[model samples]
Every structure is written in C-alpha cells, then in structure tokens.
Target: MPPFSQSTPISNGFSPNHHHQSTNIITIDVGGQLFQTTKQTLTLAGSNTLFSNLFNSSHHNSIPFLDRDPELFSILLSLLRTGNLPSRSKSFDLQDIIFEAKFYGVSHLLVQSQSNPSQFEPLNLEKSMLLPLSGRNPPSKITTTPNGSLFVSHGSKITSFDWSLQRKSTALTSFTGVDSLLALSSNVVAAGATDFSGLQILDLDLGVVRETLNWDNVTKSSSTVQGIGSSHEFLFSSFESGRRNSNSIVVYDLESFKIVTEVARNEIFGADLGSAIPSTKLNWVPSLSLLMASGSHSGASGVSGNVKFLDLRSGNVVWEIEETTDCFADITVSDTLSAVFKIGVNSGEVSYIDLKNFGSYKSWNYLGDARKANNVKKEGLGCKIECHGNQVFVGKQGELGLWSEVLMGGSKIGKDRIFRKNVLGRAKDLGGNRITNMGFGGNKMFVTRKDQQCVEVWQSSARRF
Candidate 1:
C-alpha cells in the first residue's frame, strides 16, 4: 500500500503547511520530562542557562526549533499530569509524538495515538519501532473482534479491550492450557495446544466452556494442531502426528462433538510408492461448507509439494494445483471477492490462484517473485506478500527497505505501482524471532513477532481499493 498523502493538516494548530502558532509557551516539568504548557510557570529542566543560550543562538533561525513540536510538548505534559493525552488538540502528529511518549514511558499518550489518524505521519520509522515497547506484556496473537474491540491472547489468557474507550474488559481464562485460540465467529471460539488432548470450544457470549474434545486415546501420541478453520456447523483441526509417522486433517462436527471424517495423505491423494509426497497445510473457505484446500507434498517422502483442493462432503480430492513445493506461509481469502493468495516464505514469490479458475486447464501461474533475474548474484532474500482486498502488500528487508503492493491487473498494462511505505523490518536482537502471524480487521493491521510477548498494531485510514 502507498503511504497516505500528507495533504491532511496536522490535527494540532501548528502545521508544516502553515507558520508557527502565536502562543508564547514556557516550560513545565511533568512526569520527569520538561514540557512547555503555558507562558507562566516555567519549570524548565536543567535550568534557564540552556534555554537562554538556545534562545539567543537561534534568534536568527526562521522558526524556533524546540526539542519537539509545541503542541506535542503540551499534550505530553497533560498526559503526565492526568494520565491522558489532551483531546483538545486541533492537530496531532502521531508518529513523532508516539516515539517520544514510548521512550519517556507515557502510557496515556500511547493509547490516545491508536484512535487519532490525524496525529499520524504517513510512514514514520520512529513510531513503528516504539509500538512493541508500549504494551505491558507481549501478546501471542492479537485479533480485533467484529465490534472493533481488540482481543489479545497471551499464554492461556485472553483479554479484550475497547481501544476507543481505553478500558479492558473481563478476562476469559477458560483456555488455561491451550496454546492458541482463534475467533471462529462473533460468538464462537476455538483453542488447541501441543499435548494432543484435542481441542476446546467456548461460547464467547456466555463466557463459558461449551466443549472439550480429547484425542489422546485416539491418536495415542502427542500432536500439535497446526491450523484450524470453521464452516457454519463444523470446525476442522489439522494435526501433525507426534510419532512423525502420520499427518492428517481431522474434521469434527462442533454440534455433535464427534470426528466426522479423518483425512490422511494416502486416502485423499492416493499416494503411490514411487511418487513424491507433499507437506500439508490446511485451509478452508468460510463461505463454502465442503471446500478445503491442503498444500502438501505430492510424493511419499514429501519431495514434491502441491496444493490440493478437496471436497469434505465426500472426503475426496476434487482437484489439485501441482508443481510447487515448500509452500507454507500466510494465506488470506478476500472478504469482498472470490480470491485466495498463498505467500511463499522461501520462494519469495506470490502465486495468485483464482478459485473460479481452479478446475480449468490454465489454473496456476507465477504472479511475480521479489527476486529479480539480474539480482541472482546477491545473497540476500526478497519480500513477503500479504493479500488484503484487491492489493497484495509486499514487505522487503533492509536499511533502505520498503513495503509495496501490486494491484491484480495493474502489472499487465505496465501500470504496476509500488508503495514507498516502510514496515518494521527485521530486528537485530530478536533472536529466532520471525513474523509469526498477521491479521487485518476494521482499518487496522496486527502483526505478531515470534517469541515476543507483545503484538504490534498499526492504525491506518487507507482501505484496500
């Protein structure tokens, strides 16, 4: 996505498009930081010596440059005094103020920044780095409820918050031992873990546990539920066997609490002795009841991986998209249209396969790869793609790195555009920490860093076009 244009005026009175404000502000100390709240009561840090020298030296300068913007300075002061950013500011520069607030441990300012888009700069580097530092603890998965509430899962506890109200609701502690939880719908939720003890379902409305299906006796070994997807009546859990001898996708009827069908590689694809087997990643289309897509190795030993489209109603493989291997990463289905995008982590390529064209002769094609042909001599990796709406956002890593999106048909007419937005690139100290999970809801994007305690939430006004 392109960075939002700078045409919008700073919500605060002072604007880059306009001259400085007419107020004569004096410094006051609040929350251990010096900020100018008004002309009187000057509680300047370090004393008048520095201020006098600064004022005298900068007299010839066009605009007086304080350490930061005066409005942000006043807002920070109000936050320090009352634990809230002053809601009265006419213009707010979010990115710049947020970084300062995070560094200074201004909790209220951080919360206020989430709601006001006018405060935000288009693509600010300082604000992006300071986001994960604001939260008290890191979240494993962060999801926004349909009503615009932010729900964060940490360890076994899930907490919900009204971001606009700045209030945290009661915690849902029923999922004590579960490793992960996904909101299936507005009222239904599912959680799973690595102990191979099956899964747990909860009714969010009642805040009570509805069901817990144990698979310990059936599987006879510990298994990690890798992925979970749901239809209207049924919930599907995909598991990789703890014994490493079996890999299967098990379907369960949520209403009946029984395994309706157990799909294994051999049964689904009819594996041959000499053929290559693919590793399996299960995904379901929410609108289609019996439709499920599995990316797996086509051979017995997983030498060749391909995506298989299956019909769960008959427990039969209906179609297969072949020739690709090692296909595993973030997958998203367009909420507004009929499209599915599979982002390849290692391949640095995005294969856009249309669901409508699946059964036809020309089904799959390489939409594009980040690594150019001429850059084959370089040792570095390319970009990662995230499909949202009609655009596919790509994040590249480097000091001068960028995030761009390719419009679906824009590439063909030589009108393919690139966004100049910069994402939170790879962090140096986060050992073994990769981009674990991501999701989009409302107008916000949530990203979870692996092994980190907090999730980063970015608020944007731009919608997928």
Candidate 2:
C-alpha cells in the first residue's frame, strides 16, 4: 500500500536462443507485471521450495503472485539469476526485499540483506542482530527448538528456524483463532486455538496436521483454552471453565495421544465466573520438569495475577507467587528464565522477569525490571522482551531498544535493580519498523517485522559473541 512502482523486470531484457527458450522458458505475472525466465532458474531451488513446486506442477508457467510486489519479486528474480543482488527503485524497503528473497527460496539473499553494509545505514542501532530472522503476520509466540531453532506462532501458522537463522520449515493451522504454540519435536508442533476446541498437531516438513485434542470429549461450550505448554512426553493446556466444573489445567500424554490427567483445578481457579480468575500463561521448563505460568490481569479493585509453579507428576501446586501488573505477553525457559509482560493495562509500560532457577517458589522472588517508553498514549502498546546474557533485549512494535545498560553487568539480581548507571536508559533505537517478536538461538537472533513478510535473522558480530 506504500507508494512503490515496479521497475522494468531484468528478465524482459535478457535474450535467449529460439530452440533453448522454447522448451524451458516460463512466464508469470507478478502484481500485473509480466516476467519471463528459464525453467532451469525456476527449478534451481528444486527441493520443496515454492518455485520448484510451482514449476514442477501443472500450474507452472502462469503462476500469479498478485498480492506480492513486482519490483521486489524482480529483485528476487535478479538475485537468483545473478548472485549479486540487483539495485532497488529506492521507493521500496530493504526489509521488503529480504522477505521476498526468503519466499522465493533464495537462501543467500537473506545473508546479503543482513550483511550488506549499504543497507544497514537506514535503520541504525547497536549491532547484536544480523538482519532479521523472519517476517510473518505478527509472530507473538516464540520457542527454541531442540536443535536450537526458533519456532514462532503468528497469524494462522508456526514458522521454524535453525540456529543459522535460516527458516527451516513452516506449519499452518486450520483454526483462525490461534491461542498458543509448543514445539513438541524437531518436525512436529502443537497448537491450541482460542476457544479450546481447535487443538492440533502439525508436521512441519510435509505440512500434515492431525487434530490431537478432542473438544467434544473434554470441553464444554464455554471452556476456553488459554495457553499450551509441554514437558518431554506430556502436553499441558490451561482451561478456563466458563460455567462447568471449576477452572482447570489439563494434561495429555503425547505418546498415547490420550487425556492423562486433570492436573489441577479449583485450587488455582477457586472463584466461579463473574469473580476474578487468576491467569497464568502456560510454559513448561524441560530442564526442571515444571510447568510455569504467570500473569497479572486488571480487576475491579486493581491489578491481580500470579506466578504459579505446578507439578507435572501429581498435578499439585508446588509454589505460587503473586504480582500486581498487566497481562503477560510471553514466557521462555532456558539456562535462565525470562518473561515479557506489560505493566498496568493503560500504563504503556513493560517489564522483563528473570528467574535463576525453578527451585522453591518462596525463594524465587526474582522480578522483571520495568522500563518506561516515550511517544505513546494510554491505548498504545509496550515492549516485547527477549533474554540475552544477563540482559533482556527490548523491542516495541515500532523499534528495537538495545539498552544493554538497563540491566547489564549484574551477575545476580539485588532487591532493587542494579542499574548500569552511566549507560542506564540509554538505548540505540532502530527506527522505521514494527517488531512483533524476537528470539535468540546460539549466536543467531530472529526478528519478526510488520513491514516485511519474512523473518529477519541476525548472526552475532564478534563484539556481542
């Protein structure tokens, strides 16, 4: 929708011999602009890629990318034709080009878009990222894979990436309302829909999906499946019972694909509907074998929420901690645990919670330090945080704030935050983009952006590594 015009396609300028062109030549219309190229180039990225499949199928020659930009696709075609990335029309964005390259399955183009120094000047910030990991429809859920890939859930799909920051695979769900996502294995993903009836298991590579959770058997009409978490062999879903038996947490055995236990119920959600119900975003920490849930939601009186530690074996509350904050945006568990959430509903403030370990609930008093952002009203959004070494990386919808000084240099947290005074609150703001979500794996970081339709991946520079 931004003002951009298509450049004369590079393919139109190329000339080929009659006999050679007759058999392998292909033509396609992109955004009303026509392009012609050889089938060789189209099938070069032959394995499971869009082009390969497109050309190899019955609908090869007349493929339509009507919604996609012709100039960006031209840049992509040029990138594949010549290893050197072609110049853009200046009206388009570098991020947009990067996304087009990914969709067309040009792997090297992603590296070029991130590594090219010329493109880096426009949106300058402190360098911890390479380019971006991916571009999707606002990926709000991110999880690290067993092999260190980043799995992100946004729109109607889940996109996966390896540590190299290359997008390995993508999975889609039939349910339009996606609530939560969990990476169950290298190739399979588990997703739950908004109303608890649309739970699914998706196979990433072949794009096969099986609805693993039966709504009719366990769920009533009012039940809502808020979030999903997983242990090695088990899956846990937070169920909000609207009118049925007390609100509960349900567990499913992954091996048998059957309902194993009703983990915990009334104890956690004692109040019936109309009364305040405690919300805990479900996240399972594999190392500790504990399902971690925490959140703060607004109430009639004030903000109310809790950080609950639940036992997987017996469905008991191992520990619980309360907080006075807004709802949690997301939670991730690694060597260290980090949870990104907002302050109060209309405060336009966000916080990052850090936990050393999932030990005794009483001893786990660690909390996220808050940061205030500027240029936003009461209805505006807050930052999304990702855990890095000792510090949490902050990104709002508009820009990235790499404020290492905010929570840096402290080996352990104190009662009050140990601010890196000289550098505190000073952040390198990377402008002109809306960052929906970001994740780190090995030295690579994946950033999802709104302007682009692909995930941008950043490989760490020597300074950050």
Candidate 3:
C-alpha cells in the first residue's frame, strides 16, 4: 500500500488519462533516471529540506532534476513514505546513506529511524559489537549523548563515535587522565580528573579546550573535579580543594558556562567524616526536581558514606541518608521508577529507597538477602550500578544483571513491592574481565571492562548495527 495517494475523479467530462497528470503527482529526475511520488509523501520530509524545497518550488509541471544517484534517492524516498528503510538498504554501507541524508538535509530523519532511544530493549540486549580505542590505557569513563553518540576517555585522550557508530574522532587533552566525563553536545564535552586542576570544556572536533571552570574554595588553592553532571538547564561539577580540606558542588549555566551558584560546600573540621567525604557521584532527578549527591569513604573501622538530595534553588538538603552499615559500592537514580538504587559493598545486594516517601523510610529496602549486610569478604568491592529507562543494570565482577519492576497494577507502594532480577546475556557473554563502567544511549548499552582496551556494545539483536 502507498503511504499517500490522492485520486481525483474525472469532472466536467474530463478523461481519466488527463487527470492522471495532476500536479499532486511529483516526478523527479536523478542522474537522468525518473522516479514518481505523491506530493503528500514528500511533504513529510519537513520544511527547509531539499525535498520540501523541491515540492514547494514554482515548477510543478516540469520534472525536477537532482545530480545525485537514483538508487540512494529511491531508498530515501522510501524512508519519507514509510518512515523506515527498505530491507534492500542492507546492501549499501551505512556511511553512504548518512552522507546522502546530510546532502538532503534530512540526517535527523535517518537518525530517528535508526537510533531512537525509545527503541532500547533491556531484555533483548546482546553483546553485539566492540568500539576499540587507540591506546593501551583502558577507558576511565564513558559518556553518551541522547542521540547515541559516545565519548570515551582513555588516558589523556577522548575518542568520540558518531550516532551511526561508523565514524570516530580522537582528541588529546592536557590532563594525565580523565576521571569523570560528561557529554554536553555532539562536539563539546566536560572532562575532569581528580588530580587535574580544573574542569575543561573540550571541543572534540577541533581538539581544543573551549573553557576551564574552577571552584573558589576557602583554601585559596586549585580545585579538582570529582564528578560532572547536567540537568536540562544547568551543568553541575563536584570539586574538591587541592588541599583536600574543602569541597563544593558548583552549578553553572549550560549555555554560558558561568557559575550560577554553589551547593553542598563543606569545609572539613577535625574528625568530621561526613564533611570529609566529597560527593563523587551526582545525579539529577528531573521528575522530583532534586539533585542527588553521594560519596563514600573507607577507613580502618569500615566504609561510611552519605547521600543527600539538594534543592538547588535554596541550597538546602531536602533529604539525607547516612550509610554506616553497608556502604554502597555504586548508586544510580531512576526518574521513571521514582527511586534511588544502590549495590552494597559488603552485602553485594541491591537496595532502594522510595522517593515518594523518602524521609519516612530512613532504612534502605534491601532487594536481596539482608543478612549479608555484615559480610567480611566485601563481595561488592568494584561493582557498578546504573539506571536506564525503567530498569536498573548491575555489574558484578564480569557478570551483568538486569532488574525490572513487576507491575502489580497499583500506583501506591506496598509492603510486597517486588523487583525481579535476571542475569544479562548467555553463558558465553559472562565471566570475562571485571566490568568497570556502563553507559546507555539510544538503543545501545556501552560496557567497559577492567584491563580491556575496547568498549563492548550491547544492543538489541533486532536493531541493525
């Protein structure tokens, strides 16, 4: 069936053959080969695009000529009509299609067809492909844009892969290593390290630093970034004084990179464990209008940490939790789930706190065995946990676990709230190097393993690479 076809009936005794040549029927000549399509289908290409301009032009009767390949144009026409590529498009390289899409000013349409985030399937993810970095150093951090472009920091360099995952570019920075990285745009990224002086806004295409942001601490010394995060309008960086006595989380204007305000500023007084622990992880909860900052410290006694949800406007901690029992190895907040999740360092179990009744429930609702909270072996030493879509992904050793909520057909939280967990991938995909980090963009999950130089891409088998 055609996407759009308007048949005008013969009127005033006009013949059907004469009506067949109506202005609604569009004909195009690409490389001297003619193709026909309806004006309604071409209008879907959106305004300012080549197709829209061609149709909106004054020459309706004359066939438009385009100095392009007819084969690729046919595929693009199919896309405009059906909002998907034909099966035969597999024969052509993805790069060629991307180039043609750019020429037609319809690259966004191609991206929508291939890498939409709504297409992410947590259950069907498989170890599909590998993105190899060009150095001996393993990736310290990986970040992704909403459209699926990836940025990986290995040693002092950052490598970026386009949304299609076909082309990549590398840029070097002055830092010895990048401990935290956040992608601000397709070409700009905020990179920082614990040992580095300031957070650098880098341009990946030009391989240059656009601007450097630093915190004004009481110590009057340089500030090093512990973590970087962003909300819709603001960029947040957790910075600790080089003297290691003071720390603060600075909020900046995303557009201008100017310091808007500071929150969670702490100056360590003698033996105050809470003040000594600077937030190493920052997550913005858009739904609740809060920023969660968490950090942990290890000493001879045990590991202790704190998680604080701050109202940025007032610079006040709206909700706070102190961890003295089983400190979290890693933590992530799921806005869709309205919960904050963590994996305990000693228990090796997942836990959560309901954001709806946050202050009332001071204790974490352990999803697994609560008895193991006092384990001596440190079972969750280097585990990583992150939340994407409505699911939580946990990386323990070399294995990956997926946790999904079992809808009980109720909106309120009950005592028997259940979340089922399943190990991701087959047996062959398990038991490799220890998983270091994980990131998600578009329909793909990017995983980096300890001592591994390449980033593994886990994606749905149904989506074409």
Best by TM-score: 3
TM-score ranking from best candidate downward: 3, 2, 1
lDDT of 1 by residue, 229-300 (tens): 666677677665565444556788867768887664432224342122322344566545445445433233
lDDT of 3 at 423: 88
Estimate the overall C-alpha local distance difference test score of candidate 2.
0.54
Model 3: runs farther than 4 Å from truth? 1-21, 57-60, 411-414
TM-score for predicted model 1 compared with the true structure: 0.53
In angstroms, the error of model 3 at 288 is 1.8
Q: Please identify model 1 stretches exceeding 4 Å from their true place.
A: 1-138, 162-165, 169-180, 185-188, 202-209, 215-223, 253-281, 286-290, 295-304, 323-326, 335-337, 361-364, 370-386, 394-433, 461-465
| lDDT of prediction 1 | 0.48
TM-score-better candidate, 1 vs 3: 3
Better of 1 and 3 by lDDT: 3
Better of 1 and 2 by TM-score: 2
RMSD after Cα superposition, model 2:
12.8
User: Which stretches of model 2 miss by more than 4 angstroms?
Assistant: 1-154, 158-172, 215-219, 222-224, 241-246, 254-256, 267-280, 285-289, 296-303, 325-382, 401-413, 416-429, 450-452, 462-465
